[model samples]
Target: MLDRDIAAFYGVETKRLNEKVKRNARRFPNDFMFQLTEQEWSLISSQFVMTSRMKRPKKSLPYAFTELGALMLSSVLRSPVADETSIKITRAFVAMRQMLTFSTLPEKVVTLAQELYKLKEEVNEILADQNDINESTRAQLDAISTALAELQASRSQDATLKNRRPIGFIQPKEDEE
Candidate 1:
């Protein structure tokens, strides 16, 4: 992102944003942020008509910040907007990482679902062939199969809930009740 764009987002002047970056020079390494070359800036500026703020610029080249640098700006900037956005951006990053980490889950779930289907089919066939199994017995088997499926689903979901606080109904005190 360009310094002017990021400044606009953080609700600050482009110069002010760059001032913080300058003061906290150690925080913004080469990978985090860098100044755009004159040629690059001209090309970019030509590609897109300059915004109102961008038009008024008559100083050093604009700084280009990577996503990490954008986050780091929140820490350097001491504004309510920056602080709030920083928290939201941090949470968004965490959520994105979680999604990426769980990208392989569909395959596992499909495998479990297929196994459950095969098990249910086998149980159904066996119950069908057994003449002694009545309606009640068949119903019980169906209920058991459903419960097994629920268990498998819960087991898979447990991994995600492992780090979260448990949620459940809390029994009231006898006197309170």
Candidate 2:
């Protein structure tokens, strides 16, 4: 998380939070907190829609605190509100960790794809076995099969996109201009 975000959560100004971090520098190692490089900041800004404050000009890059660094903040900030906010932050971190450990979205998507494939196969079999089918009925069955194929193709495309990493910014082709 960013220093400004942590300060907001703790009900303190960003300057004050940085001050506290500086005073207790020994508590936070390089891994616990670090400043974002200009390149990293630019990439992140381009990839994400940030608030006005974040987009504002600044002399230096903002500090990013790891979960341990955020936890260390509670010790440095001795206010009741800060303490309460720290507890919530800690809980959020724990929940995120747990969710990561037990995530099933990919598995669920695979299962759904398998089921759709099976259904498609069954539909195809039914269409093939229908010897006495009228023209309208055959057309309807063909439409259903087409729809299922399109749905499967769409799902596969979505899965591929989801797995692909996001590129923050791309230059437009000169030919397009």
Point out where model 2 deviates above 4 Å.
53-57, 104-177
lDDT of 1 by residue, 1-177 (tens): 788888888888887888999999999999999998878877887787544434556557789987798899998997799988777666766787799879979988999999999999999899787855687688999999999999999988998787555567744355365
What is candidate 1's TM-score against the reference?
A: 0.47
Against the hidden reference, what TM-scores do the models get? 0.47, 0.55
Model 1, runs deviating above 4 Å:
51-56, 87-177
lDDT measured at residue 12 in model 2 versus the true structure, 0 to 100: 90
lDDT of 2 by residue, 1-177 (tens): 889889989999888899899999999999889999988877776776654445445666789988889989999998898789889989988999889866977788899999999999999988876754667688999999999999999999999997676666754455359
lDDT of 1: 0.83
The lDDT values for all models are 0.83, 0.86
Specify the poorest-scoring 10-residue window by lDDT in model 1: 50-59
